[model samples]
Target: MGFRAMVCHRFSKLVLLSAAFISLVVNAAPWPDGAKIAVTLTFDLDAETIWWNDADTMTGNPGSLSYGTYGPKVAVPKILALLEKHDVRATFFIPSWVAEQYPDAVRSIAAAGHEIGAHGVRHVSPLQLTPEQEAATFSESVRVLDRIAGKRPVGYRAPSWAVSNATLKLAARAGFLYSSNMMDADDPYIHNDPPGLVELPVSWVLDDAPYFWFDEDSWNKTIHSAASVKAIWQEEFEAAYHGSGYLNLTMHPQIIGRPARLLMLDEFIGWMKRHEGVWLTTGSAVAVYVRGQQGRSP
Candidate 1:
């Protein structure tokens, strides 16, 4: 075996298989203009402070607090006119006491441009507070959603996503750039134990509050059928549009703003608007495009 030491071991195995296929095509096209799949239609709105955050799952029964005041007094203007008839730019989070008891429906979901974030000031569950009461509930939920949603909420969605092993270092010291209360991963990750922060992950089977929540003290949840939860969210957005992964849909505005579950979320947003590299964004524009594709900054 001496043809110049077998051509220098086949040129170091072709430079380690061309650096592992250019790191698998740069982590399989991490979406932007050349998108492949990154949809986020989030919403937490948790009105009536999600039933007073816990008195053993409080059911003080004013018809269970008017079922959380039918989410901003009648389902957030029918989920903001079905996301302004699908012009789409979704992401709502809120719980600064449901934005101080519906500050004009959270200022009309931030004047319909959407993207509010921070969901805690009464929806509780920083696993029962006390890291100085969850850092004074994230500084009074960023000073009450920046004095009633006048902008100042990068992101943070815990209250019931229940994080407390120092909830991502107190949401990166109360200045979150991302943290959709974690589920682990479908993509988006950058948290070297509180290094620059960015997580954008969530799931409970693409969450519609465990198949459309209803309660008279949790009547063993059955009401499902918005055409079977939009056929399980169009099969998890066609398996994240064939693996470019990231779906992140968690809804509630008193349970999918019921009108047959908002027309099954307007026919599942016209089946994800006949997909084609889908990047229907907003969880802070997918956490600022995953922190500008991991170069990282805010």
Candidate 2:
């Protein structure tokens, strides 16, 4: 390589490095009440709806249904109790069918002061539906949640993070404060296709299900150790903490409910709490904060 070219490349890298450092500096604002970073722990209470359609109800294996039933009946309460013990609130995304089947579970989550968001009607992916069907499904899920939770939910998380451009717009039109399904950025950004909706990104690395949800009867059959999952999650949290950005940690009840796994969850929450300058909050609330910050220079 030519000396001049090498010199120019070095200068370019220096400029890029400087720009990156400045970007982080500008985005890092002291969180409200002097928190260092924002943390959102979200649970998808998709019990039974994952496999409880009319056909499944009539002829499905009782054992398949049992996995879904385990979530609401055994897992949610334990998760709630742990949250209650810590006096921390979280966001729970519930499919409409699950809400219909387990209204008491939804009610209990609400009564405990946790935020509820629509996850869909039958736990089906939007990609599988046409635009029209996706719109209808989103509306129906919102309606069911509003009816059962007695308040309109202001957030939406498409199951499996499966979404199309139009599906997100539908969510904005439904008046959601945020959509927690995208993975485009490490932090939140604004989505304005339907106008003024926030995107609080979620990562599979930050989700417990991808690591812990293994079933011998199905294709997914590799359960990771709780310790390994905890280690990676903490590493992600540390990066977010240093960046002074948001961390959206996703979890599912059935996946993280086992005693050993729940202990990992508990310690995760405890670790975050021990970090003196952390804001542990729900997704909707973080959306509010990010929206407020958007207008300001970052």
Candidate 3:
């Protein structure tokens, strides 16, 4: 090739590479006050309601209720004390019936200055309901949770992490500021639905249930060890921290609240605290900040 042609081709390649690098830098920019990443600890306190209400799986197996009761009866306080000791704020998503039956328990979580988001009434999945039914359930749940918690919850997560398109619109219409059911990205974004509610993504790998919850009577399944969980979570945190993205770790009082698991959890938090530039907050607070982030962008 001619020298002139070779030089021009090299110049064009350099320009393209520079533009791509610039885009990555912009997308991975630090959060407020130069925080490299945002870390949130969220728990879905399904409790006994997850089993007692499921006639197909839990019906006639009255013993299962006792098994589930560990969440509010024992596990919650352990989880709360740990969080308080760490000086970390978290978000708790509660099913309405659990809150109604265990108002004191739910109230304790709220009292600790943590964000409470709706999980749904009776732990029913929106996928099981007609769109209208889902919308009605969401609206009524918002009302009940507000009454019990004494604050209008601005966030909602479908009983299961899976959600239909209708769920997004219905949640937004029901006065939710964000939905944590979707897993489109590691970082938060605005849903395309009208009013554009913030989308705080969740993943199974980041959840405690798949790793800690065990079944002996039926499925007879057990999950990873506490050491494995702590190691994997730390690995994930390091990657997200360097990318300057958001990390939402989903935990469960009934699962991760076990003494050993709780210790592992504490270890993970201690690791996070030692890391600089990590902004720890609740899912709703993340939504509010992300919305402001959208507004400030040119």
lDDT per residue for candidate 1 within 69-94, as digits (tens), equals 89888988888888888888899898
Looking at model 2, which ten-residue stretch has the lowest summed lDDT?
1-10
Candidate 3 stretches greater than 4 Å from native: 1-29, 53-60, 217-220
Best model number under lDDT: 2
By summed lDDT, the worst window of 10 consecutive residues in model 3 runs over 1-10
What would the TM-score be for candidate 3 when compared with the true structure? 0.87
Q: Report the error of model 1 at residue 276, Å.
A: 1.1
lDDT of 2 by residue, 99-180 (tens): 9989999999999999999998887888888889888988898889999998899989998899876878889877888999
TM-score-based ranking, best first? 3, 2, 1
Tell me the whole-model lDDT of each prediction, alpha carbons only.
0.75, 0.79, 0.78
Off by over 4 Å in 1: 1-28, 31-35, 40-49, 53-59, 65-123, 131-157, 160-165, 169-179, 182-187, 195-198, 201-247, 271-273, 279-298
Q: Report lDDT (Cα) of residue 3, candidate 2.
A: 13
Error of 2 at 112 (Å): 0.4
Best by TM-score: 3
Question: Which candidate do you rate higher for lDDT, 1 or 3?
Answer: 3
